[model samples]
Target: MENEVQRPLADFPVNIWEDIFTSFSNSDLGSDKLKEKHITLKETVKESFMASRANPIENIKFIDTLCRLGVSYHFEKDITDKLEKSFDCLDFNQKIRQERCDLYTVGIVFQVFRQFGFKLSADVFNKFKDEDGKFKAHLVADARGMLTLYEAAQWSTPGEDILDEALAFSNAHLEEISSRSSPHLAIRIKNALKHPFHKGISRIETRKFISYYEAEEKCDSTLLEFAKIDFNLLQMLYRHELACVTRWLPEAPNGIPDSMKHLYRTIIDFYDKLEDELEKQGRSGCGFHLKKSLKSTSNGYMQEVNWLKKDYTAKFDEYKENAILSSAYYAIMGVTFVGMGEVAKLDAFEWLSSHPKIRTAAEIICRFTDDITSYDFEHKREHVATGIDCYMKQFCVSKELAVHGLFNIVSNAWKELNQELMRPHSFLFPFLMRILNLSRIIDVVYRYEDAYTHPEFLKEHIVSLLIENIPI
Candidate 1:
């Protein structure tokens, strides 16, 4: 091999400084004390769930609170059972037609059912429409109702014209209402406008909602306190995870290329720590397999580098096959695997290894979305051929047509993801949720641009979830 001249490959600057992580501390978070408090709060919340089960309305509201507080995962069975029972007792169609049923309640029910994978017709909103078949214009005055409707609208699927219209109607009204609403309501509205609850990360949404919930006049102190304690404790756990990564980075294998060492160490250390935790809980071997998966992921990056060196534009299928490995989707699944039962963990790994349609859909959505948004900036520098380049060259289409085609691909990927999520799969639901959440992240990060590459877009979420604590 000829000695190549050393050259700077790209001008990508580090957007986040090291000091940001250095300043994080769990001392104030009081992990041990918070854990104790969290347990007591969990019991209280559980009791609340039990008590509300007899009262359908109260149970629904409580379920909404659990979701908004981001602690729904902690009580998934309880929520599922309650919602299933509630659905059986109250015919959703009949409830929506009742003269007494308000928009807020109907919206909440619609959203909750869809969120948990229960099929609900968008036509339930028909009663709220007038002769012209438009949502009642007078409904805009009820900001909370409009907000809830707007959120429910996000669950729309292809050809759901009612939901599409509902979204447009609710959005315009909410924007107008938010501008004149009280400070507290305005904050919630602004957050919703920026990132719909359906699309927001659960942990981040929980952090934001705790504050919003507290400001409500009817906020349950016990629930509010539980949310805060639980969030801080999780923050403590995350801080410890990052600390482990920092400690392990310098100890990575020397053979790893300098360019890839940091990422390799971070993912490996994360797997190691998670494995240790899972082992303590009697789940073993997941970490080892996850590490193997990480290696496969890294090889995907190496494959891209080789292609770039050869000035190769891969076939679309070839690009997709490699893109799935490089998308970091496996890493997300690996982290979520920790603490899962051995059967579930092994099953998840099996499904992941096979590159199931759901996982492939998520990766395709992520890769194409990223490439489409970032191609311009990437093209200005030394970069591997992206999906955009592959598709354009393979199809011999104009950039505009290629981009349009890519959007269609992303849409089809979403449909696949939705279909996979709709029915029982080989893996547990929670494991599947990790894949869904990863896809949702792509939706947020690549909504208009690549937010991950441009860190400023994610800074507010980071600050809210980590740097700042909610005032009790």
Candidate 2:
């Protein structure tokens, strides 16, 4: 066989971004003044939670605020307890039958319940439908309601036609309202349209929401201040973690490039320690299986290198098979194996190795969205053919059509992911959440653009999540 021409070099250079973490100051992090303020605000928030216990509506709103502000993890127990109590007291049937539920309350309550794994019927939304069985047209004017409805719809399972309808209906009206809305409202709508709250990374959403909420006419000053303080403190902790990782980069194995070695070694070391811990706990089989899973994840990088060396456009199916591996979906699954219970870890590894539909769906979302946004830059470089190239070459379609087809693939993949999430499964919900969160991160980073490769769009998130401290 004749040797083929090597792929041309891409215009983009290797990731050469400066180490922003090196400048982070440890002394300034978690200062006495900040710690005192954090405690005061935290107590205030906790007191509010106690006061709201008598009012389910107030309690739900408080829980929703914590989630939106990205501080819910700090109060997980309190929020879970409040939600459980509220769920027990509030009767969905009576609330709907008595016409006591508005779109905002119903949307919030439904999303909270579903998010916490307290199964609720999609029929809660059916009351909003008119006699003709369509979402009430009057609801279109309420942008808050529409946005919440749009987010709540993301929890829909298979055969839930009402949620499907809610998604389409709310999306259209929200898009329309965005054009004429106030500057802040318009931006919020635009962002929600691009990345719904349900599919957004919590850290990124909190950073964005802090600004938006601050600008609201009815914004709670205490909550706003507390959110800012908490965000900055959390960023300090993340900075410390990154610094610790950076300190160990020089110890990574040979052969890997300096640029890539840190991340690869970090992931490997995490699993190595986890495996040791599992063995110490007498879960030797689970530890061995997890190590095997890590090896499989490493193989994915090797597969990508092999594909790039070939330098030919593959059919869509062929590209998809390889792309899923190359997209690092397995790495996310492997990482979750750490700290898991023995049976859960073994079962998760088995499910992950089998290439479940949900994993494939998430990989498709990651791979296609990346290809769609980065197509031009990638095509210019020495890269393997992407979904765009495969579809175009196989069907003789235009670039535009190829991109549209790939988008359809991403959409279908999301539906598959949503379906898989709702179905009963043997694996723990936390393990499953790792997959879902990976998909959500893809939506945040790749929607409308390749935020990861470009990095400019991600600067705000990095700064807010790690570098900058909010003013007291």
Candidate 3:
């Protein structure tokens, strides 16, 4: 202890979750009873999907609901199979089919199809526009219609001016309309306005959405119960994994700057174990991509440290080039698809290595969103110039303007990401889903602050995910 070096150190918050996971085990959870109920409810939900087939519109809406509820992973095959069958078969745009679809129906349908990669056109919303190419005034009267339209606009691809207008129009209206709407509807709208479902992480959004879904007038009690139980059961498994990890950490490698070395070895060991596991599963070349990402991320971190140590402010472009790598979403993306069987082949990762549009888009989202939320906290200590700082210096803008510019980049990236996900299926849906989810993780973790560092703010998330069981 006498040899321990004394130096300036970060005033890191105490780990609020200390000893929490270490004391817990999944074995005591009532998983068997939950599973029994889960099975029944799942079947009921599926049977409902099957029975609702006569109305593709309603069925797809339910599919989207299940997804937002975070239980869609359970019905992936069924949803896809049924969707491929008549989602295309219905082809029900009012202009073409003379259908009696309302703004809510059209908006939800457009959003659902696009989300599943259907390449649905923004032109589908043209009827809602008046001759001046503006959304009709009466359309704003219906609060649900505005909310759904706002959500659908969140899925806009590049160059979709109609959707651009819709976003502006609906966003302005939603903020104003919330006060006049019913409490339930207003709560849902405010939630959407703040964290639009299209761009939110599934687990985090699911936790928030369960409450809103439960409050719906036509809340499917069976389906809602299934989601709650499934979430709690998964929470138990997550805790068990953490408990195992906590037990293992102290035994790992150690050195001067002991924590860093320990973390480095832990990460390497993870990839090595993952590679070995993948090899056993005949996913040999996947390790190459994983290691490649790890190397790139390491270099990015090194670059950032060099900048900070030198007190060098990089140009916005230079900072961005490194920031994306430092985001580590590229590495995260590769590992995500490693377990996904044949869909993630060597060529698949090769494509990622080439800096595909979707990958870049996701990286931008991750990096900039983090910078916007954390720069103040980060500035308290010596740190590399964040993207916001870089933009400010480059453009001679205020912090607010610099943040706005970076956010515009994030928004544009989301649009580009949306376009890339359009119906043509250039890559397997599973692989693409990984990239999407990685981006989603950024949105949740870095929304208002660096919750990853100041995790006290994420207490609600921690409790909902690991501690509290949704009462039946």
lDDT of each: 0.79, 0.76, 0.83
Per-model TM against the reference: 0.83, 0.83, 0.90
Q: Whole-model lDDT for model 3 versus the true structure?
A: 0.83
* Model 3: residues with Cα > 4 Å off, grouped in runs: 1-8, 95-99, 256-270, 339-348
Off by over 4 Å in 1: 5-8, 19-35, 52-55, 90-93, 130-134, 158-161, 255-303, 310-318, 338-344, 391-405, 423-426
Checking candidate 3 for backbone clashes, the offending pairs are: none
- lDDT per residue for candidate 2 within 1-472, as digits (tens), equals 4775554655543554466565555774688988899889988877876774554766777788788897777787777777676666656346643566788888888887777666567888888899999999999888778888998898876678899899999987887888878889889988888778888888778888998989889888888888998888888888887876776676666565544566667666876777788767766656556556556656766666677777667888877777776776676666655535555645567677777877788888988988899887776657777888899988999999999998888877877777676536435667777888888888888887787777878777676677666665
Residue 102's C-alpha lDDT in candidate 2?
85
In what order do the candidates fall by lDDT, top score first?
Answer: 3, 1, 2
Lowest summed lDDT window (length 10), candidate 3 = 90-99
Location of the lowest summed lDDT over 10 successive residues in candidate 1: 338-347
Q: Write the per-residue lDDT of candidate 3 for residues 1-472, one digit (tens) a residue.
A: 9987554366789888777778876684666777898899989888887785556777878988988888988888887786676555655444323436788888887887787787777887888888998899998899999999999999988899999999999998998899999998899899898779887767777888898899888999889999998887787777787798898888765553556556766787878887887778766877878988998998899898789778899999999999989989889888777757766777788888888889999999989999999988878876779998999998899999999998899999999888888877667777777888788778877888799999887798778877886777
Instruction: Give per-residue CA lDDT, model 1, range 1-472, as digits (tens).
Output: 4885554366565868465665555574465666788899999988878873444766777788899998887888888887777666656457666878889988888888878876677777988899998889889888888999998887776667888799889987788899889999999988888888887788898888988998899989998899888887777667666666676766766565555677678767867887797677666666677888789789899999899889899988899889888877776666666535665555567667777777788888888888889888788877888888888889999889889999988877875676566545555677778888888888888877777778877888788776666654
Evaluated at residue 417, the lDDT of candidate 1 is 75
